[model samples]
Target: MASWDVIVIGSGAGGAPVAERLAAAGMNVLVLERGKRFTKAQFEDRDEIEWCRRDRFVPSILTDPHTRRADEAAKAMPTTDGWISSILGGGTIHMSGFFLRARPEDTKLGSRLKEQGTTGHSAVDWAVPFDDIARYYPTVEDEMGVSGIAGGKLAPLAEHPMANRAEATAKKLGLPIERTPRAILTAARPDDDRAACAYRLVCASYGCPNDARGSMLVTYLRRGEKSGKVTVWTEALVTKLEKAGPDRVSGVRVKRLDNGGVEETVTAGVVVLACGAIESARLLLLSGEGFNPGGNVGKNLWFSLYVDVNAWFPKATMPEVMTGSPFIHRSLMVGGALKADEQKTLGLDRAGMLDLLWQHDNPIHRAERLAIEGGGTLWGRALKERIKQHFTEGRSMLCEGFGESIPHAGAYVDLDPATKDQHGLPVARLTYAHHPRDRKVAEHLAKTGLAILKDMGGQNAFVRVGIGETLILQGGTTRFGDEAKDSVTSPAGLVHGLKNLYVTDGGVLPSSMTAPGTLTIVANALRVAAGIVKQAGAARP
Candidate 1:
């Protein structure tokens, strides 16, 4: 068995920041990642089959299945509905990089909902206020080389027909539109080694070949390795947290995936769990007895509610639609925060954001969707003609709404009674169902999206309200707050009753903000690392 000053589990947006900071603070740090690390050459080839259809980044459901059900009374079935990336940098490697921060009101959602007399939901104010985390946002932005105007500027607009038309229509309708911040570098920075964005259009589901996207693997993990105080072990799965006493975690039990079933327990002065919301809760549940004193370890799980609206425009009237466009760096936050009258009519407490962009250029995805729309009968010349019509005749645009999923007692994760993984441990089972208010809010946003597209002279505009979970943006399993009876962690991200154990991932987020959770996760991890470093200094002899 080996020992270190600090051990961080799961090297993604949450874990990597803390690992780099701790190593920089002169602590001997060890990082454990469950997946293999891929080289730049491996990700250079833009193979849709390997990255999308074959599940290269995600584990197969056959060996590591998670059961899901609509409610407690319903029988759970094996599904991949909530599975995120299992690779070294997690979802950040394949994320679209819409790095928007939570609004100030998002931090105090609990009090807001209370004032509005919203019922049947479990919303709570964050123990750590927005100002506490806002100070660290600049550090993350500078280190990650973010590209956008801080106070919202319109200098770098997407050069697409629909994007330009949509902006004009938004102005006509008196809707506020702003440039979206991305973790991608627009130009090479003098301090960083990563290249600038190539604008290849294969960003969301594929890793960046040029290292332009600010993934944890390319930024913090690289810096940590260069610092010489950090050691990272890939294909190392942490199975359990070893406890020294009733209120403290001493180390972790790791299983080597590359080796022949070799398991070892490594000690550390402090242990931080940053293995995402679902996995973090599962790990806590697996380490039984002394943990879960508050009975809230695996409760209050939530996902960002989404609604996708798409529209088409003919190239004859809109010739620029046929031209290739770069990333559509536009977003609308006009109606995100609903008024009291609107909330009353919608039967909801909160609304969400609208992201405007050009449709994905993946031929296979487009063909599949076309085939489905045509009742799966198009083939040969008909398929080719349809493809040509789609590319030459018109272009499509997407307006997606990412809304808050109000927390409730019914939505949660627990150990599956019968399902076990290849390692013979029980898998996590998700029990969830969208609240009635969620549907109302999504429908409201969809209407707004449809109006924008229609005003922009779009034809065949349609909306699809997502009833299932957005697996990539999940949180709140180990919620942090002021009370141990309700929350699993403290404001500083320490487990409520534990001294040395901490959680710095989405698991500590009390509310699912109206935007993507990646930026907030990284910022909070930095704040938690600072606290851990201060404590270590105070205890030094």
Candidate 2:
């Protein structure tokens, strides 16, 4: 077996950057992705009915079962809400491409929680400061070809025509609404392989046909391939990390999806697991009981506490009908520690943000809206009438809100003994109980979301919050902290007590920052890559 200098698992937002940076530094790197690789040609299939309704983009829970329960006493049932892409680029392939940066107050979240007398998980504050992490923001943007404003760190984006409805609404209400920072290209660039946004209506949960969206597949991973030092093996499912000796991961055992369950082992001097928060934690647990002594590997899993408010307006209410754009043109952030002046109204102290989108991107989701509005049946004249009203006279607008899930010890992931995947490995089971504060904040935000729609002259508003809404936004599994006993990884994202093993993913986020999580995930991945490069240099003998 050919041993590599670095082995990075899951070539998505997290792993791709690390692999690319290492490979560019002339390290022999191997990237293992569980899903099949698809170029821009494969992205043309925008089948809303098949892909959205069926489990085409997502894997079946039966094969890769992730059971969920509110608490330890409740029996866990298999849930499809644990939806994430198993494709080569992971969730980035189908992302809406919002790039919201975290604020200073967000970095010191643990202190805020303590000040408020709440019990958050072990590593609530980041080991590194906001400045340390924010330093890499520019690199991530330029490398990925994110278009907005000056195109530098913390810079704003040039406004899009899609923002017309939102801008008009925000202006009418006298609310401060700025252009959203997006990874999708608005202008052509020499460095980028992707074209500008084709204005394709099917952006949400669908791969970009124009390659305009700066997914890691077309951005970082492609850069790694061009470096000629990076080798990617697709459909290679990593089962377990093999430990060589005390505090060292020797190699990884992988099963091939296409080649008739053929299994193989590959050696590496260092292993970086970036299979996302849930799956990465699952794989670490599967490595063996001894791999995680403190039980911090899968603990503290949390999602953005979220809710959506959709309301319709008459066609005459706006200049023209919006053909569905997911760009959240307007946003209002509810910071973790409430400002003294604002505390009187918001009640509890917590972190949250509200986003405004034009309408539902997929027609199938519109049908779902019809069910929620028209009641149970999919086939009826009333359903048709409702759908027609939404498109013509009553065009809809959305105000989506997200609050931070107060990371606690009770919410976690563990291996399910009863359920196993096609590979016969025990699946990841989640025990998630929402923090009382999170539920409270979400309820408050639901009210606030309705207020936003009403401000935009929305009649017949619909608001949804509470359970089953926020499961899609997950984080904080392999969290990093200063103390070895409390956290899984270091501030640099290396696992505690393990020298050659590291994690470069959202799993290392110390706390939940209420925004789109991908921008931070990418920035940290770059920071981790810099650390590895420094390590490799230090060890040069």
Candidate 3:
């Protein structure tokens, strides 16, 4: 058994910053991760079966299952397709590194939406505003080595440049474009011995070969370890958080995965749960009593809005074969996607993004997508001939869009009634469904994306919607509010009743955004860590 000043329950976008901050303050910080850690050498090029399909970043369903259903009345079934990365650096390592921020309108979405009379669930303004959160954006961007373009300042935006292809395409199509702020390194860094991007041109579900992707493993966590005040126990599954005497947290019970079923406990003065949205709430629900009396632990579970479009341009028309959109990935928000009158007809409340990219080169990935397009198996000669013609002759491009999922009454997560993991702990049951407005937003984004593709002179166009395309960008399970009765935590990030317990992960993000919440989660985590430092100082006798 060991003791520390703080115990952090994850090592992803949310947890890494806090752990590093607390450790840099010279506090004894312990981080517990429930997954395997991959070294730099192990991350080779294109092993989709192991990294993408298998339980590399995500856990396998057979051992750790989650039940999913549309609502309470429907029969829940097992689903392992959700994007829950359980590796050392969590989703950060596998993310495409799109570091977009939520706007002021997004922060006040709940109230604005309320005034619009669109109430499907608990949509409200965030306790913290965009300006308040803006203070840490540059710090994170610099530290994470985000590479953006020059000179395109919109409201609540810095002078970031737009990618050439996206900018050019948008101009031709009469669409507004924004530069994608990615956590990918544009140049080699001498400090970390990490090189610049080789432009291998792959981002989705693949680990970086050059460390250009600013994962926590290569950034904050690296800095935190250098402080010598932090310790991380990887592959250590935390089952229950223990309460010693009164109502205070005493220690955490953990099961070691590498060793043969070794169980241990670590005492801590404070506990930070940054284990993503799903597991964070599930862990809280599993905790015994005083720590969770209000039964508000796992409410309001939701996912991000998503749509995908694919088109193939003829080689004869375009002439040269287009490789990939490496540096300049471009995106744009549908301008009037959220006006009250416009939304009344569309049933949507927020803007959506459409990112244009060159078609991927991975054979396995292509095969999988082809299967989906054909609606059946296409093997032997038919598949070979298509591959030959496409690779050597045709050019392809993809336009993917994402909107916010409107949180509703029926969508939530809880402990499964009978299902348990290998550790004998209850698995998380996800009750998720898109609101009517959310579906409308997805439909519009998909249609608009398809229209853009057709305008670009593409053939054999296709689109996909709400088929687990955005399950990875999930949150809203443990949202904070102005009052304790209705929320799980304070605006400052502490649990309602448990003063020392803080949820610094995406779970605490009260509202969903048009983009991925990883960047916001990291920024808010820095805020939470700062508050923790102040409170710790006040307690020092």
Highest lDDT scorer:
1
What is the per-residue lDDT of model 1 for residues 1-541, given as tens digits with 9 covering 90 to 100?
8999999999989999999999999999999988889878887978888888886887778988789998999999987766677888888888888888887887887898788677788879998989888888878877886777565321232345456776898798667787788888777654557887777866778888888888998899989988899899988999999999877888999999989769999999999999999999999999987677589987989898888888888888878776765666678863377657776787666688888877777779888777666246677888888888997798777888888888888899999998998899999999998867777778877888898888888889987544435777889999998988889999988998899998999988988888887999999999999999999999999
How big is the positional error of residue 491 in model 1, measured in Å on the Cα after superposition?
0.7
Which parts of model 1 are misplaced by more than 4 Å? 151-161, 339-344, 347-349, 374-384, 466-468
Q: Name the runs in model 2 displaced over 4 angstroms.
A: 120-123, 149-175, 323-328, 334-341, 374-379, 466-469
Off by over 4 Å in 3: 149-165, 324-328, 334-349, 466-469
lDDT winner between candidates 1 and 2? 1
TM-score each candidate.
0.95, 0.94, 0.93
Indicate the residue-level lDDT of 64 in model 1.
81
The 10 consecutive residues of candidate 2 with the worst lDDT sum are 153-162
lDDT of candidate 2 over 1-541, digit per residue (tens): 6699999998888899999999988899999988888878878888787767777667787677688888999998997656577788888898877777777777777887687676555437778888888988777777776665343543343333436656676667444555566787776655656677776656768788777888888888888898898899988999999988888889999888878878889999989999888889999999984567477888888787778887776767654445344354556653434445455565566547777777765776876877676345655887788777666665677778777777887788989878887788988899888776777777766776787788767778877544333565677888888766778888888888888888888888877787767888889998999989998999999
TM-score of 3: 0.93
The candidate scoring highest on TM-score is 1
> Each candidate: what lDDT?
0.84, 0.77, 0.77
User: Residue 122 lDDT in model 3?
Assistant: 75
Q: Candidate 2 has which clashing residue pairs, if any?
A: 148-157, 149-157
